[model samples]
Target: MTTTVLQNIRPWGAESVDLSIEDGLVTGLAPHRPGSAVPGGTEVLDGGGLLALPGLINSHAHVDKSWWGKPWVSYGGEATTQGRIAHERTERSALGIPSTDSTELVMKEFLRHGTTATRTHVDVDLGVGLDGIASVRAAAERLGGALEVEIVAFPQDGVMRRPGVLELLDRAAQEGATSIGGLDPAGIDRDPVAQLDGLVQIAVDRGVELDIHLHDGNDLGIFQIELLIERTVQAELQGRVNVSHGFALGDVQGARQEELVAALGEAGISWTSVAPPGRGRLPWASMREHGVRLGLGTDGIRDLWSPYGDGDMLRIALGFARVHGLRHDAELAAAVQLTTTDSAPFVHRDQHELAPGSRADVVLLEAENVQDALLRTPRRELVLAGGRVVVEGGELTL
Candidate 1:
C-alpha cells in the first residue's frame, strides 16, 4: 500500500494539521509536528503552511458546448431562451466543434482549478443524438484517475415539444448516462404533468437520477415545482431528484418562500444555483436551514446564453457570497462550502469528507486560513484524489 503525508497544512484554514494517507484514504489527521521524521517509502507533500480544503464540486454544468480556449462569438439572436438555443445550435454546428477536443479542454480546465468532480448536463436530441454523452464519457475515461464526470442526458429543447426526445433520453441513459435531465415544462413543454411523468419514468426505469432545468418565473415556475414535488412523492424519488435554476423562488414573498423551502427539504429534492444576478437569487440560506441540498455551479461557459462563465467555481462562489451580502467570516466560509462540502454529495453520491478514513480528494491553497482562501482565492499548490497527486505547483500532471 502507498502512503503519503500532507504536512504543515491547515484544514478549512484552521489549526495546522498533518494528514497521512494510506491506500487513497486519510489514515490520520493531527496537529503538525515540527521536524517530523520521514518514514521510508512514504511520499511527503509539503503544504508550506497552506490552507487545505475539500476539492470543489461543480454540480451543474454543460461541458459539451463550452467555447473556452476558442474564438469569441457574440450573441445576435432574439433575447428569448428558445431563440438563444437556436442560435447556439446553429453556431456550434457551423463551427463543427468536435466533442473529443472541446470536452477535454473544458474538463481539463476544471481539473486545473481544483474541481475533482462535476455533473455535466449533455444535450440529447434528434439533432445532437448522443454525441455529447459519448464525448464526455471519452474525456472521463481518458482522465480515469484525475476527475469524476457525471453526464445528465439533457433535452435542451422541450422533452415533449421535440417529438421523440423522451425515447432519445432513454437511449442516452442506457448508453451510460448517470442521470435524466428535463427542460422547462411549463415554459417550453407547455405541459408539466407529461414532462415530469416522462422524466421520472425514465429515471426510475434506468435506476438513474433527475436534474431538471426550471426557468419559468413566478406562478408558472412554482406550479412546475409543485408538479415535481407531487410526482417525486408519488414516485418516491425524493433524494434522487434536483431542480436547477428555480428562478420563481426569487419572486415569491417571505411566507411563500418559506413554504416552498420547507416542501423541497421534506421532499429531499436538491437545488443547484449558478448564482445569476437579479431574478436568479434563491433562498439559499433558508433552504440550507431547512436541510435542502444546495450546490453551486457555473451554468454555461461562454455559451450562447451569455459570454460569461470560465468553469471557475471558486470565483463563482465568491460572487455568490458578495451578491448575497455574506460578509461575516462564518458566512463567507459557508459560501466556500457551497463549492466543496455542501456540493460534493450532490455531484457524486459517495461522500467526499476531509477527515480520517475519507477519500483524500483535497486542494491545498496558498492562504493563511479558510476565509483567506476565499477572500484571496489563492492558487492551489497541490491537488490530490485518492492519495494520488493529479496537480502540482498549480499545473495538471495527469
Candidate 2:
C-alpha cells in the first residue's frame, strides 16, 4: 500500500494536523509534529499550515457541452432556455461539443479550482445520442481517477417534444448512468403529466435516480413540483429524486411556500442551485429547518448558452452567500459547506471530508477560516484528489 502523509495542515481551520492517506483513502490524522518519522517508502508533503478543505463538490454541471479550451465563441443564443437549446443544436456539431479533449479541459479547470468530484449532466438527445456520455467517461478515465464524476443522462432538449429521447434516457440508465435528467415538463414539453410520468416510470423501472431541471416560474412551475412530489412518494423514490434550478420555490410567498418546502422534506426530494443573480433568493432557512438538502454548483461555465463562470465552486459559494444576504460567520461557513462536505450526497458519496475513512480529496488554501476562504476565493496551494497530488502552488500538476 502506497502511503502519503500531508504534514502541518489545518483541516477547516482547526489546529494543525498531519493527515495520512493509503490507497486513496484517509487512514489517520495526528497532531502536527515537525520532525515525525515515517516508515520507509512513505511519501511526505509539507502543507505549510494552509487551511485544508475537503475537495469542492459541483452538484450541477454540464461537463459534456462546455466550450472550454476552444477559441472564444461569441454568445449568439437567445436568452430564453428554448432559444439556447436551439442555438446549441444548430452549432454544437461544428465545434465538437462532446469530444474527449474539450471535456478533459473542463475537468482540468475543475481540478485547478480544487473540485475533486462532480455530478455533471451530460446531454442525451437525438443529435448526440450517447456520444456525449461516452466522451465524458473517456475524459474521466484519462484523468486516471483524479476526479470522481457521477453521470446524469440529461435530456437537454425537451423530452416529450422529441421522440426517441425517452429511449435514449432509458438506454443511458441501463448503461450505467447514475441518474436520468428531465427538463421543464410544462414549459418545454407542454405535457407536464406525461413528461413527469414518463421520467418517473423510467426511474422506477431502471432503479436509477431522477434529476429534473425546472426553470418555469410561478404557478406553472409550482404545479409541476407538486406533481413531482406526488410521484416521488408514489414511486418510493425518496432520497433518489432531485430538482435542479426549481426557481418556483423562490417565486412563491407565505404559507404556500412553507407548505411546499415541508412537503419536499417529507418526500425526501433535494434541490441544487447555481444561485444565479437577479433571481429570487431561496428560502434557505426554511429548507434547512425542514430537513431539505441543498447543494451548490457552477452550471455550465463558458458554454455557448452563457459566457459566465470559471468552474470555481468557491466563487459560486460566495455568489450564493451574497445573493442570500448571509452576514453571520456561521452562515458564511455553511455556504462554504454547501460546496464541500454538505454536498457529498449530491455525488452519491457517503462521506467526503478531511477525516479518516474519507477519500483523500483535500484542498489547501491560504485562508484563516472557512468564511475567509469563501469570501476571498484564494488560489489553492495544494490539491490531493484520491491521494494523488493533482494541483500544487495554484497549478495543475496532472
Candidate 3:
C-alpha cells in the first residue's frame, strides 16, 4: 500500500497532528511534536497553522442547470420579483435547461468547491424531451472520479402533466437514479397533494429516496406539504425522505407557518435550501431547530431557473454562516455540514471529520484555525482524494 505522511496537519484546529495514509485511507493520526517518527514512504504535508477538514458534499443540485454547468431559471432578484421571473422565463425559453453548458459547468465548478461528493437532480426527459435524465446520468458518470456523484431523476415539470413522466421516473430509479424529485404541489395539478403522493409511491415501490420540490406557500402548498409528510410517514419513509426548496415555509405568515413547522418536525423529513444573500426567505435556523437535516444546495448556477452559485462550497458554507448567524463552533460544523453532513448517501462513509480509517478525501486550507477556515476563502492549499493529490493551492493537477 502506498503510504503518505502529512506531518503538520492542524486538524480542525487541533494544534498539531500527523496523518498517515495507507492505500487511500487515513491509517493513523498521531500528535505532532518534536522528533516525531515519520513512517516509511509517507510524504507529510506541511499544513501547520491551517485547518483541515472533510471534503464538502453538495446534497442537492440541478446538475444540468448550473452556471458553470447550464441557464438561470430567471427568478430575477430581490429588486423586482416579477421582473426576475420574466427574465428567467425568457432566458430559459431561449436556451432551456439540460443543456451541455449546464451539466459540464456544474460538475467542473462543484469540484472546484472541494466537493468530493454531490447528489444532483437531472431533468426528466418530459421537461427537455430527449431523455434528459439519461443525459444527466451520463454526465454524472463522466464526473465520477472527479466528484462522488449521484443523479436524481427529477420531474421538473409536473409528472402527471408531462407525457410519459411517471414511466421515466420509474425507469430512472430502476436503472440507478438515487432519488425521485418533483416540483410545486399547488401549481402542478389540482390535487397537488395527490400528485406528489403518487410520485412518492413510485419512489417507495422502486426502492429509492424521495426529493420533492415545492413552490407554493399558500394554503394549497401548505396543505399539500403536510399531506406529503403524512403520506411518507404512513408509508414508513420518514427519515429517508428529503424536501428541496421548501421556500414556502420560509415565506408564509402567522400561526399557520408555525403549525407547518411542527408537523414537518414530526415527519423527520430533511430539507435543502438555496438562500441567496437578500432573499426574504431563509429556513436554516428553523429547520435546524426542528431536528431536520438542513442541507445547503446550489439550486441553479446562472441558469434558467436561478442565476447564482460560484461553484465553491466554501462560499456557500460562509454564506450559510453569515445568513444564519452561526456561532464559531456551529459555523465550523456548518462549514463542513453545508457540504457534508446535510448531504447523505453520497457519503459512502458517514464522517464529517477526519479520523482513523476514514477515506483520504480531505482538503488543506490556508488558514490558521478552524475559525479561519469557517471564514471562507478561495485558498485551498491542497486537496487529497483517495490518497492522490488532485488539486493544490486551488490548481488542479490530475
Local distance difference test scores for all models: 0.84, 0.94, 0.68
Name the best candidate (by TM-score): 2
lDDT of candidate 3 at residue 70, scale 0 to 100: 29
The number of residue pairs in model 1 that clash at the backbone is 1
Q: Model 3: what TM-score?
A: 0.85
The ten-residue window of minimal lDDT in model 2 covers 276-285
Can you write out model 3's per-residue Cα lDDT over 1-398, one digit (the tens) per residue? 68888777778667778778888778788887756767566676666545787777787677775445322234554433334434543455456545564676567666655777777777765445435665565665665476667777776656666668778888888888778887775666456766777787887799888888776665666676787888878988877677776766766766777667767778888777665665425555666687777777766666655555677777777776776677767556655566764565444356645777677778888776666776756477777776777677687765
On the 0 to 100 scale, the lDDT of residue 355 in model 1 is 90
Query: How far out, in Å, is residue 346 in model 3?
Result: 6.1
C-alpha RMSD in Å of predicted model 2 compared with the true structure: 0.8
Q: For model 2, how does the per-residue alpha-carbon lDDT over 157-209 read when each residue is reduced to its tens digit?
A: 98999999999999999999999999999999999999989999999999999
Q: Where is model 1 more than 4 Å wrong at Cα?
A: none
For candidate 1, list the clashing residue pairs, or say none: 13-370
Write down the worst ten-residue block by lDDT for model 1.
93-102
- Residue 329 local lDDT, model 1: 88
